[model samples]
Target: MTTETSPDEHQQQEIRLALSEIPSRLEALHFVTADARTPATVPNHQGRDEPTSIFNSYSPHLDNITNIALFHNEDQTPMPSPDEIIISQRGRRRFNNGSSPDSGSTPLRMPFQRTPTKVPLSTSMILRSSPRKRLTMGSTPPEPEPTVMPSPTKPRQRLWRQGLPPAKKLRMIEEGGKPIAQLNEETPLSLLLQGMSQQQLIRLIVGDLVAGDAETELRLRTRLPMPDINPMEEELLHAKRQIFRSLPTSRLCKKTDSSAYSRAALHLNEFKRLLTAHTKQLYDSANWDALLDYVTMAWPILRATPHWDSATHNVTRRQCFKLLACHCLAAVKNGGPLLGMVRLQATDKNLRDWARDFDDIQSCQSALSKAISKGRATL
Candidate 1:
């Protein structure tokens, strides 16, 4: 027996059948519109034409129906009409030159390849291909080429002169007992005095005398030998020797005696005075040899003095002796004595204070002792 279907079941079966016909319906629509002359229609299940009223109920306008077909009802905008679609298809076919969609190939002819366009050559390219012409102003002349000077050629030596010495040779032989060439000949005094006023001539004469004196002094100093034992030096030496002998004895003996200390002080003063006077004489006379002897003999005596260990008084006493010896040597070597007592006093002060900051008094003392030893060795 056949079971009766419900109304809902019948509606469901109709929807399934409609869905199954959708693809075929779209295919038929495409085929009808593919040709503009064909009439557009909806076909029934028997492939017979159905009236437009059936589709019109779903969409009132043709544009709305096309939109629904193209966009599956997602978009509401109207689609192009059949004539516009036909015109667009015709343009695309013309551009592609009848190229097949399945052939997987592009059109051979490009619009840009119709005719080759000539591009203008750039300035650099033109310059590279051809020589550039310089533009000249009216009546202006071109710059002249620079003139090159020829290099100087050295004189060629003759075959015979190749091994010979130079033309201008330095003379090795001295002329016997003759005065050599002088650049300036000596002028006579009378001619020299001819153009002078009284004051000018006096000044000239004074200057000549002074120059002569200085020249004579220099000659004498240079030519004279160092004196050995002159009478005055001998006397001084004798006095120095006597003082040396007395000084040490007095120091040893005066350790406890007040009277002995007084006597010793007196002797010390005398010795210093004698030393100063002797040093001055030797320096003024330029008696370096005798000065050397005196310094060497007195150095030992000065070292043995009672004041040598006294911090406050020893500095002055040692400075005095050092100044005397240094000044004498300086005068002997430096060509002249120091100018003033002020400089002598300054020397004494410097000798006492020099290098005291670094506790380097021993270095200064050793240098002075070495100078005395050197002087003695020279003598």
Candidate 2:
């Protein structure tokens, strides 16, 4: 990092700084035996003070010094053992010298043929640019008359380019399928809450950042399930790093041309998907207890975004949390209030309370309709 050093030299300098510590380590180890006392502190003539134990590394100083000197060489770099040094310079890691007799460099491309094997191969190998349509012979009982079975080469499996894409491929025409994304497409964070003014987006990102764990904890710790403070730290860190709003601060978010709100919403949506994946992974791994922990954290996020009440009718943080919670629960096949609310009626237990609670949804709808009418919030 010093101004006097070039980039490579700077890297070497950093390595040297690390290497310089090796001698100090050797010196520190040297004193381990020298400082050892006798009787209680230092071992007796037969090392009886420690005979009942095996804690002592009692190699003599001459051997220890030789080992240290060999390891921590004059250059201060830890010198590897002879075998290791040979392996490092002339073993598996050694590369082709390009001038070995009767040898040329490996071809940039190699051709292969399949033999009913499912061995992993490059996409290009499977989907070669062939003028001839590939066809596979179909097996069927012979007909009375001679006939050719449809041998349309099993439509060669589609191949997607890996690593750096070829220029020719990009130049090729687009056909019917999912639209490919551009290399420079704006991310969700750059679109959603990023649409708001910088301060507004920052505030929203804060909510977003907080919303994940807050809603999850709030839902999980409900009277309906177990409660614990152990997971709170996990939630806090998740919020601090990831749950923050899609647009924390920048002109791009608030500008009319930006997709500030949509971007944030989309990110929240994807996070919900991630939770779903995590739930599945946990279930597959049979981590039932951990699954419950995640579920406890997740449920509240769903309830927070619920359109169940008018309190969250506006583009409310409560609603966002509810939406997230519902998505997570739904993803797990653990259908919760989100999917059941509409069906609840007078016949249901505590129907009056349910009806009262559902009123929030109606109120929220009304406010949303108003917002749309006033052009205050995007639907």
Candidate 3:
């Protein structure tokens, strides 16, 4: 009977077991001589020693000797390398044909064809594969149709010149529809006077007739080149009062009259003369604010000039009519209910008559829009 080993002896045994794992080259001896029982040598035939290596450094027992590539599995089984293991597994899978010998079964080749993704094939010509040659919808083609770019066209015009079909008439209401009395050309010359600009005024009355913005109106009235229109000393005072009356108790033009009425009158007369005489020029050298020294005045004179008509025997009374028309328009400005801020006639009669007379008044309202539509004028 053996007794239990001491701890020191046990430790020694464990050390020996661990040392058995060391990897090393082995020098194996092979006896090439005849069997010892027969003889050491046969007379004509010599015995030779030869060695064939099956295990040496590769031995599992001696794995610990160098362990240049030491590896451990969970089960502690020795495996060569990750790449070699993968290769071995792949080989095993390829060898499996799903048939057993005893069953007398035929090895089955799978029906579905497997296609491996290939690296781009290298060749001198560099031609495409068969799939590339075929036109599949999802696949992009080599040469696409030249994307036809549509020609850029200009924007179309909205309003046509020929005009549109007539609109249906609308019925009017009773009390609300009761017509207001229409104003006429007698409305006021001054109505056109408000809101006009200096540039408009310097131009001829023919240009003024274009019916521009309100600035044009004011300029025509107040700054027009007519020095003769300056009121008398008392009259200028009255005119200022008139302007105040024209406005509601508020919003009157400030009195430009420096010395009450007389000085203001003189100032106005000079201003009128200055504007009317030298409109084509900018301004004459004069002390405009020198206390109403009336160097000139607008003498509201009327004269009928005679001109021979080459076409007709009758002398046309054109000047008379012109003067009358001008004076009448002037009257409207001087006379007032003065409703349309300075002197705009808002009455239906005045509007319609103006539209008829000018042939341009109504057209002007639509004119700016039409010009924009046609690309004639810029926004």
Candidate 4:
């Protein structure tokens, strides 16, 4: 050169040259992007002074290459433009509408603020409900909850009315043939009851049937105290007699109506009361002889009573026999040699065969036999 160029002028000339190459480079980029699905071939757009090729020097994709720098090399990574750099420095950029970064119409965005939507609280709660957690691979699953079983309920018990005769033909409820005791006549009523607890008095009245006269019966019906009569074995015996007298005269059959069935049910109810209250007392006191006597008296009556009904099962009769067998079993286990004598008498009377009538009683009978065997061993 005839004249030496200044440093500032030289820089200005290089910038102009690079600016002039931008249009052609951009055109080449658009052409490559437009036909990106097909393989791109090198373009012949570079000037003779520029020896290197853009294809050999840079990646083909616009997303992988940036046009911000005036110079680039084979190993150089892409850098953001001025707008992208500014946005990136501020925060992550969000597009209001989903658009590519190359789209000129797409504006540089700041971080978006999430405003609350105008939805009801209930609706929002439903929408925001946490999703069920998914089990991951190789993780153990949760154990299932234990299965609860319902307990079997007892069958409904039949009710017995006061003073109702066992048979339609019988005129009145029998008070057994035994006379009411007059031993406590000199004692005050309070003193007579003083030795006994309230529970004992209640058991005597409700269970023992100590009341023998019409006045006593009336008071009992009215839930009044019968301090006049003392609790005695005589009253218990009379109650037992009343139960025996109440046994059904005939079995319930197809010809039997509702009213007849009802009367039979009442009789069974009385027998239940005898088993629950009076027999329990006899067992508790270890009154072996009296217990044997009642069993002897009851066995024949039970054998005579109706064991089945066409309209219903023989549950009541079966339950009564089961109670008798249970008492016998308890006495056999606890009463020692006395129960052996009772069992011998039962065997002579052929009463053990009666156990065959009820499944529950058969079980008790088996237990009774085992208990008797154990008692003999102990002796």
The residue-by-residue lDDT of candidate 2 on 15-56, one tens digit each, is 665455546545554434322233113222244442222223
Better of 3 and 4 by lDDT: 4
Query: For residues 1-379, could you state the per-residue lDDT of candidate 3 as single tens digits?
Result: 9999999997777566435432322111112222222212212221344222233324463334223222321323353765664455444235444464643343322222122223243534443545533333223446767898987997787664457765667767565554222234565656655546766555746454635767767775676442333444334344334433333233363332322333244433443343344321212322221111221121112111112233231122232223233333333333223222222222223435534333433432332233233432221
Superposed model 2: Cα runs more than 4 Å off: 1-243, 248-259, 301-379
| Highest-TM-score candidate | 4
Q: Higher-lDDT candidate among 1 and 4? A: 4
Give each model's whole-structure lDDT.
0.50, 0.42, 0.35, 0.55
**C-alpha-based local distance difference test score of model 1:** 0.50
Cα RMSD (Å) per model? 24.0, 44.5, 26.0, 21.6
| Candidate 3 ranges beyond 4 A from true positions | 1-141, 152-154, 160-225, 228-379
lDDT by residue (1-379, candidate 4, tens digit) is 4999999997777667656765776655544433243334546556777655434455655334433322232444456666665455466555555465576664443233222344453662533221232122122346689999887897676565656655456645456553223354777877667778869877888566855667777876788432221243345455545544554455653324444456556656765676577677777666655565565556556655554546364676667777777765565556555556556446434445764665454554555566556657766
Per-candidate total of colliding backbone pairs = 0, 47, 25, 0
Model 1: residues with Cα > 4 Å off, grouped in runs: 1-223, 227-258, 285-293, 304-320, 328-379
Pairs in clash, predicted candidate 4: none
User: In model 1, which range of ten residues has the least summed lDDT?
Assistant: 128-137
